[model samples]
Target: MAKFALLIGVSEYQPGLNALPGAVQDIKAMQRVLQHSEMGDFADADMTVLENPPRHVMERAIENLFSNRQKDDLVLFYFSGHGIKDDSGKLYLSTSETSKYQSGELIQTTATAASLIHGMMERSRSRRQVIILDCCFSGAFAEGMKAKDDNTVDIKNQLGGEGRAVLTSSTATQYSFEQEGEDLSVYTRYIVEGIEKGAADTDNDGMISVDELHEYARKKVQEAAPAMKPEIYAVREGFKIKIAKAPVGDPQLEYRKEVEQCVRNGKVSVIGRRILKRRQSELGLSVEVAAQIENEVLEPYRQYQANLREYEEALAEALQHEGTLSQHTREELKRFQQLLQLRDEDIDLIEVPVAIEKDTIKQSEFLYQKSTETLIYKLRHQLVDITSTEIELAEQKEYKDEGLFERFTERAIEAIRLAQEETLRFGHNFIGTEQILLGLIREETGVAAQVLQLKGIKLADTRIEVEKIIGLGSGFVPPELPFTPNAKRVIELSLEEAKTLKHNYVSTGDLLLGCIRLEEGVAVRVLENLGVNLQNLREQVVHTINLSKNKNIQSQ
Candidate 1:
């Protein structure tokens, strides 16, 4: 089962484009990874790397790579280049000469890297196609082309059968960064090293599988930079990968110094790194141990470091408070001495200031009753500020469930239950969210969701036109509806509406009104969970509802 790779990385553009040291670095590093990593051995077949290639050359490179592939064969296509989108978010592959970055029109009328990939996939007889695109705006490259018009068709959905798998360097709107000591893009560096580390190398042989490479690339990228996520969208299960298992150690923080020393001293390495790669095969170590040793390249004691920082911070805060209190005491003691001097002639017992020895001691026993009054006043002001924030948070948390509107919790709980079902029925441990959404979508008839569903609003329609509404890493909130004090208030507002002239048990359409009324409630929160803006869902729902009403009237 030999696998072939079509690797394309472009760094130098025909001047005036964003300088992409990333593309060249990505290709060279991946090549070494493919050679030394287990995937390179397992898929140890023909691989081509087109460095700084022109557009036409890149396309040719792909076509040539697939020239020998078969339906059962695995094909991996890697691209590292600059990408941009049109106004419609249609992604375009930068030819060594794509001038002027167009914001809105970027995606509408552009030729994309994904389109190129789709062409390769359609032409190839390969059963599983794994594509890794490590470039700025890489997610845009896959937006229009990877999935087959159906959101469920592409690599991310893991629905591949005869199609390819797609892995992107960054989601839409963001750029990938560099790793320390690695010339490759941070993402590419880890991906290649991950493969070399045998995290992707499944067979214990020195070869990494295509799937393993993808997972390794994704997990490593995510850990290194949580903000810029590397995604793996698979259309099919191509390879049985042996993920680089972490070495077994003390579950608690019992042997951390020993662990750090071992890592620093070369007894360990993280799962995906190039530094100690040469020693991996020679170690004859378990995959877990090997992976852990490789991960050490990053030094995974941040939690302990965080704890240490927190301790230092607490000490500083305590000292600051101590300084402020001491200053207050010094002033109070001075006032007490002045009062005692005033009372010296009368020698009054009640007004006598308590005499103390040293500067520290004199301040320590200064008048407490007056200080208590000032402390109480400060405490009240602090309490007021804290109280307001807690009240606001309480309001927000009340709708955390969106009053059953967003049942992320319920869905999560149900997901666990269904996971049990899956294990009981099929005996697999990986119960994914996609499956949960699929199952829930089929079973749901809630009043709020029904408005969209009734008019043929497919949840999967995001495939065709969602990225335009929500750019990468964006969030949205819906518009306002009438304030409803209670559930009955929602019903009352619906009844007051012109459309629901005659109603009985409240059709799902009426629930739309209810959702809109409670727009400030769970409805908006649920939309946020799906990454759907309230405005987008509102317009879509209105359009669908109107369309349905028109059809019904026509029939009548």
Candidate 2:
């Protein structure tokens, strides 16, 4: 019996029908195997190859192949092109002329009806008929055939015909795919491998059968294009027609399978090393192709390593502080250490503890639970807030004077130091406005003390009253004590008070005026409790500032 094969592949197509350069390669690969001397062993004269043929030419070729065929002749038809389903659900092998506009009509005219091919194959004189299709939704070719058999149904049971079979690249709902940078479609490549290399002999037989070929191609295609599932349909018990004689094996495929299995299992480093060793060269793959495969697996790992390096560098820089860490820096170190599983040995540059003291009186550390950066920022803002005088409906200019900050009078600086000392003596972690008031009262010869003395507000009595309002706190003195917000506000107001009085240097008089003008705080309440008239206190503080300013002016 003569074996006749017709191969049709379309790479060029009309607009809206994407061109398939792989389709041409697919047909050529299949033709090679079929015409091979010991494989398919079919004569070249018996094979018909068409590239980008029109619809009429394809119809004539199909007719001529099946019409004059003898009963015992074997007819194999293969198509690698675009398979599309119309609105009526009929499948069509799209031609080069297929277009999106009036797609159903265009497909009907330019494409071959898959059902028509099935009908023609059934009516053909030859019972030994095989139709192989490697196109999107090619499984639609066997849509009408159904039987009580499993995936390997006998063709006679489904179509009630002997020696008729169909093999498709993908299921009706699936789109066959082409690998990026590869010349063949995923399904067709495996089909070619099955025919040429004899990997289709799943049962270890000496020949490659149609069922075995489908089994091998389906599995390989699924591995390459996970979304596709190749299918096969057959008639009668003669479905196991040996298409190709089996070669010993394709060692290239064997190595590729191992590499692919490693990739699937996430063994990137192992695969990367293997690829660098040029192990893929055994499979006839070039160094560039191997590198491409390696890069795909290693790209994510490389990114993670890069990020890890940056993280480690940041963590190392944080560890190099001389004194106590800022609460923000401490917390960052803590989180990073946890993430990287960093041990003491990993960061041996410093002998310091990574954690910040949780209950410390240091304002930055104390506010760490709330937010370190915010508290420091707010504190820094107080510098501006304190130095500026507020006027009703007046635009305030931002003053940034580092010199003015360093030019505080010696007595004024001494008073602030005393306030911090008094806070510690009172077993308080924070230096409140009350402590600042005590500092002003205790600076005995300062203009504030002299003014208070004239107003019958003695230092001893004021201290007693201050202590009464604020009882002693727990004696947990931290290494560094920061002023309370109220105290810091009082200091800011003192700077504003000095500016308002036209004094270049802040004094005890400015401190007292700032305390009196401060709307809220224990200082205001204590002065009020002592029945000190705020208007008179303001007058006395302003008069003291004038007297000092005049003395300086006179001395100059």
Worst 10 residues of 1 by lDDT: 349-358
Residue-level lDDT tens digits of model 2 in 101-191:
6533444677777667767777788978877877654222111111100122122233335687788776555546553356877677878
User: Per-residue lDDT tens digits of candidate 1, residues 466-505?
Assistant: 2233223222212211112443344344444324434222
Global lDDT of model 2: 0.63
TM-score of 1: 0.44
Models 1 onward score TM values of: 0.44, 0.44
Scored by lDDT, model 1 comes in at 0.43
- What's the TM for model 2? 0.44
